[model samples]
Target: MDPDGDPARRVRGHGLGLVVAPVLRDYVVVDIETVPLVGTGPEQDIREIGACRVEVAPDGRHLVAERPFHRLVRSEMVSSVWGSGLSSPSAAAVDVADPDAGLITCQAALEGLAEFCAGRPVVAHNGRLHDFVVLDAACRRHGVPALHDDRLDSLDLAHIAAPRIGIELRPNADGSMPPASRSLDDLAAWFDVADPRRERHRAVPDAELTVLLIERMLKTIAGSEPVRQLQRQILQTGRNPWARFLEPPPADGSLLDCLEADTARMADSSGLSSDPTSRIGRRAVHEAGIHARAAVRLDEASVLAPLSPGGALVTGEGRAFRAQQREMAAAVLVALADGSQRESRSSTSSAGRLAVEAPTGTGKTLAYLVPAVACAQARRRPVVVATHSKVLQDQLLTDIETYRKSIGDIRCVLLKGIANYVSVGYLDAAIEAGPEGPIEALALAIMAGWATQTATGDWDDLSISQIEAAFPPVRELRTRLSVDELREFATDQADRLCFYRCALDGISTADIVVANHAVLVTLDRVVEEASHVIIDEGHNLEDGATSALTETAGSVALTALLDCVAHAVSGAGVLRRYAAACGASPPHERVDEAHDALVQCRRALTELGSHVVDYVRGRTEVTVAEAASFGVSYRLRPGLDTGRAEFARARRAARALADHLRRLSGCLALEPPMSALGTRHWRHIESELGGAAFWSAAERAGRGVAPRPRRCLQAAVCVPRASVVEPSEAGVGRYRDIGRGCR
Candidate 1:
């Protein structure tokens, strides 16, 4: 029999595609115990099957487990736990019951378990990840009904319900995270329930324990029916809500046409404008050479066609082509084209700004975006559209996709500062360090799950009120480390930056880069490539600019960076690892120099924070109560001498630490390595010490002129690498990932 033709094999193919599964009132709880089918492979033969049929009472007030099934199965093959370790019990533990309860055949056991399921949904503690996975593999080897039901995991429900109901997971005894070691044991301990069998986990007892825990969690959240959040997650087990980004490109044989997704894309690309009402308008643009892809010249009539009544946007796209929208778009189009020509003609020319004070319903966002996208495509340079607020940036991004789909493939991206992304390496560091408290634990667990599933690698979506109600650690996760950093870190380690989908370095060729004004204020080197700039909501620009331009060495930021530096130099840190990779440890005195400088920097930061606190206390005009009610504002006035000495001290200390770090990096980089992966690591450090994440003031050439720091965070650190990881393998020219994530 062809395995591909197997029905069970087909089911497992789409297992990860679960958007939802029906949640029935009654279900079967299954727990299976198995050992490797051989001395070496992943194939496992089930040694025991244990299950209980759970039923919700007619009134839906309680859960009941009535029919129970247990079997010690006979196997033709001798088995051991092998390298699987504690995940499976040894054969000795399996036979602890009387040495001869007389085992059943593999076929008999599977048939009996399927009968026990009796056509009900199956629930288990981490069933989808473990139990059924082994079962499916076993069934494939043996050729039998796999008994795969609508699989549900209690572990997912616990993660969701823990915070809402005030529950904390019992951190694992080995100090590792649960869910790898995720077990019925943790849930049983939390709910004060335990597996009933005397020796524990003889199968049926474990199933009973899971059923009880699920009941407790479900009932605790609400009445007999599970709370909607819990129910949604349980049904959609693998479909993490955070895993999604922009609407998925249409699927195969989609309803609209043959190979509809491709057809739609072709239609979108084939014309300068898809507006059916503007056929005559497009003909005129084509004659003006404006409808041609790169030959698209920015002209008023062609640019406004897609935004006016005759455009495709008025039909399937929800936008009604308003005359004012067209008028504004036309005005902006002419100004941008004229300015672009002027700038190309002379360096000092004023690429002027045009502002429109139009009514609220005039479709102002589309007005600017239309001209911007058209001009960018025409001029063959990225156009940057800066929104005054994050909300408007998001809204404008949506508007571009919605209304402007007819205008064409505007290869646009929402380019944000690196802080808006979470780094996978740092996330692993946080989990390995363990959360400081339960709220932190819950947030970490949710983040870990989101990292696996997210396409955008966007930061935590927690609302402001939600973040404030939680602890400070949630904010820490949000600010430090990003996916852009991992591309470099992983490159040196030769590890796949696989877990994150934040397409690292994807924005370089994007036709339009939508950014917030704060990003614009940084004068981001990437945004500097823009041929045209569109500033939306100019009314609020001054406030956003002033707030962004203000410099502050935040207590939170300073401490987080300090922690990363400390971790890199610790005894088990990257220094030791890098030294070993290079065939020798640094001289003890040299290593000591690095540690001593780090210590001084920490002391200086603490002193600086203390000085600023004291200075703000007496200098601010507003009272503390009023400040707390609104927000804290303190201006650092020069010559007023508030904390100036402390600031100078801290900067010097930081610079000293940086200097020592560079000397060590240069020492190690000069030493070559034995293996391909190690060679890659050494060359990365060897090349970038001039000014990587933790830098030395060693200079590097930018052109034959302007110098730029060759940035790198230590191979171990994740926070500041900001897409500036420089990898130089000999004869392969230096390339840097400016870390612009594109969707």
Candidate 2:
């Protein structure tokens, strides 16, 4: 056993006493150690080196018994340790006789390890730290990159294996938070694996012992079917490994308050109160929720089983949408079922893709949900319903809750980004900092309080316009909030704004996901990566995509900017009115330039509108492209030639605005990061929304197609044959239950 050998020899002896258990079928356990030389600094030679390798088989696990590689070199120069005290200690107490010798020996040991563990994934306890350092140092010494290959960490494995087992290597015996280093034997004993008991702390035997411990733990945590079920749930939610991780909170946190506050501030700042009846903001939010719910139901309906020849006999008064919803739901059901069958036949199936053009008020949410649930029940796949607006997401949740009561054992989860959930730690930080910290934090606190008061994060729960009265001014004072605070806020907000498509893409583990059209557009961009997509609100798809693809610098917007500039430059009271109307700061340079442009544009528009009215009154048919060109030339071009004087000034202002716009567009555009989350390419949509001529031009540009005449067409031609509006127009009763006298 070489009793009176060198310290490296002693460590090798100690390592040999350790036994390693195997985790994988063909597992190779490895350990590496490096020592820095004195005076040599970071660019020094290794003072000592040691390593070990072992393997396991079904018959029995055995350590490959070639003499464990050991080397030692005397340092030519004195050097301090590279890692912190948290790192492992060296093999010996005294300096080596020669550092070069140690490097040579270490090189030999590493060479042996490479040969031993060839064609195997390296297993190490905290492999990134210990093995990485040793290998990197060795590679540097050898004039070649250290071994580069797939490696697994036993520490991570341990966390996966025995989650409750809390083992800390540092602090030594006192457990008073001291040196943060690990010993191989200590870990083996702690984890109840074979102890090599080698007096010397070399690599090979230590690696063997680690392998043994990991193997035992793997067996201990092996599948029991029950464990697998638990694992699936954990995997699905991607939550904490401990206890029922899939469960959500009773309510969404603080979002309603923040939203309410934001909306009120927006209204106040923009002078929305003057009209009082202009419920655009309120209605936008509410209708978003209502439509989202309808969309989901519509999606559900598109998958349901079709009605018989007799159809569903009309019973109740409010059941107007039932028959149509059932028909739509049946269509979706056929899609899902056929899609599933097709997938069984091939690897991909488009059967689950259903595009329904149901109108807004037709109870589409139930329609979608019914068939979605049916498909889910049949195939055990989730029903994911997504909408474009947050308000609609809230409405879907309400519908889910309502449905849950009516239908038993229906599980639904409304997922937002991680930011939506309020963090206790952040709240504590804010509360500890007192009221002087960030206004955002303070606003967040108020929002948190409101969350507690309300049952859901629905803004409608709060009285309209009370948010500003309740929380008033958001603190403008500068505060150095910690990254933790910022992160908490960011994460919470992300949750609120997270696109449903992203959630679906991320966690395919769910049974149902609800989202909007933007998300569907995003899905289409990455359609190959997703499974079984159905887009509700089929009528809105083109328009929504068009809106996404287009941009408008309208007269109203240009006027607003000019108003701000006028306020800034001329100190006019009208400027203040502009600010009040637009909810923005007075513009300085860019605003002035924009104002000038807007003036020219308004004059041009006056002329163009007159021309258009004249043309419309004079003729029965008009081409959109011709009109758009006329409008653009007359309205937008004059401002262009009045250029170059303010061009530099505009450019200077524009550069900053452009940067801001780029960032905002990047954030909002359905492209890249945003597109993956449900933002469709807005540029394409924008091109379409530039009126009839633009759309005509775009189509012609793409396929050499000509534009259709833009005449005052009947709404009946545009409406689909399946549309209820179409049937009702023919003197058919449009009541909820259209049972008899229809045909």
Candidate 3:
């Protein structure tokens, strides 16, 4: 009832009256508001604790009582770090005391919240890391007892629940906008569960809204069989959720192993030697596979049966199949068979290419997956299913899991790039180095908690983006703490321990392999062997491929590279420092030349960035005209022309940058950061263009390449389609005539 009793909560033209609702079960939801305070140092202080305890009637259709608890804690300190993004709470909503109504201290607020919760399991959106961490830290500072032990993270729970309840949180079709996935506000809007307060960045409103949203989700999946398992998963999460990640995965035997044996048996029956090592046997198997796939009738495939309304999918999964899904599935089936018929081999992206314009709810995943798996089984080889994101990759694996029994159990495995796995060596080094700041400290703690519990040790499995959303700096920790030496992947005996090799080893036996587009484009052995491929998010294919193939350097990144070179030349780098300590000086004139190039590189980068910005403005204006609240995306279209003079100036600066690279290449390998840019920037600088690309690059560079500033953005060097050629040895087949192949 006391919606605005706390003057500390800035309304900011947002609030609404309460709308009471029922819950699926009796539960309590709590939200806490915190602001940085200059206590012993820059630490957070809880200014408010708002909680809602909901009880449903025996019928489970109505509410008993929806009790709300709110408290405003006194803020005695006026000093704190303003730079922290969290200080908006401090600046806008300071709880100052008045003679009429003085605010209570944080200790008093906690005690009151404990009494209000009264042994009910407390829930919060991102409570495990965000809310509970703040509370535990504050309790330690105040010497107060911990109030709650059993907690559920609505953030993690919502993700687990979304698919179980058939909610689609994937990106839009073109994928220009990322999903507004996990925020309490976004979730409320999606679930049609609104906070009447319409308020946020507050305690109780968020807590109340969290309860309504979760109740709605739980109710939607209540009749399903996974609800109990979902409930169990929801309970086990928060801080260290025990996932036996490193434990031996159960044998996911191939779904088509019997079929393979059957093919071998067929070869033997035909009086051909069944050994794969024999030429006759190899020919027999290949011909048999081709005939088997050719014989597959698209409309009657067993894989598609599981995706039908009157089929096992509906009978078992509680989800009805749509007609659009069947159409797409048949189309993919036709495309895969067509690719098998083609004389010229094509890249997985281009092979049997048919763009099905599937909107969000088209159930396109199952459409492609079932067909892809069927094709793989028919061919007796793996079918690679590629997605642009970990979200879809995870969803693909889940879909396979959901329909595995109905479709006849299939062996599938997820494979990510080596850099995605954590390096135990790097992690130990990071732990020994300790945290430089509070965010780093928190990030390390979260990583440590996840490291021991995670089986995959892959960044995506950890859902790193969630942690990074809370702390932006956490993104850097992926590589900073990921596998330090990728060469360790060469052999099992390699020193540094990482999980990527283990993941890769599973691919050989897998019937269907799920992977992100980045890994697929990188030309893994899986792509070479995969007889059929399904790119689910093909709209993002061009961009992902371009990003995988290009390297960009910005002024900030260029400056970092320069600093590395300078350190090496100035006897300050690791190698030079050792020489300096041994009383050996570096080459004097060569050192001076290196330093001068470093300075010139900085100047040229600044100049290039300025002129380049002016050049890119009016070339058909391909970027979105509407301003994004999130941020603007600037796409640099290829073949745009600037004035010859302007082009020369920019080109001169670029030439200077290229020259600087040549000089720095000799500077003790530019330490590591210069080489350590990222997988995208894997040093195409000195790489060979193999005669064909050199001329193509020269032609494209003449058209004036545009580089965006301070971003790892690529300069589009698109050439005439006819001029480009793929190496014959390249495992991927060339789409000589994509216009013929593409729909």
Candidate 1 lDDT over residue span 62-138, tens digit each: 35555588888865454334543444444545555546766877878888888878787777776655687777777
> Stretches of candidate 2 above 4 Å error?
1-317, 320-322, 339-353, 359-362, 415-429, 437-444, 450-464, 469-472, 475-509, 522-530, 542-743
Distance from true position, residue 710, model 2, in Å? 46
Q: Enumerate clash totals for all models, in the order shown.
A: 5, 90, 3
Against the reference, the lDDT scores of all candidates come to 0.48, 0.36, 0.49
Best-to-worst order by TM-score is: 3, 1, 2
Model 3, runs deviating above 4 Å:
1-303, 316-318, 327-362, 374-380, 405-408, 417-419, 423-425, 428-442, 463-474, 481-489, 492-497, 537-543, 556-604, 610-643, 646-656, 670-743
Cα lDDT, model 1, residue 680: 34
Ranking by lDDT: 3, 1, 2
Per residue, candidate 3 scores C-alpha lDDT tens digits across 384-444 of 8889977777677667765564556465656665566765444533433333443454455
lDDT of 2 by residue, 480-546 (tens): 1111111123244333332222233333333355555544443343233323555555556666555
* Per-model TM-score versus the true fold: 0.44, 0.31, 0.46
Q: Cα lDDT of model 2 overall?
A: 0.36
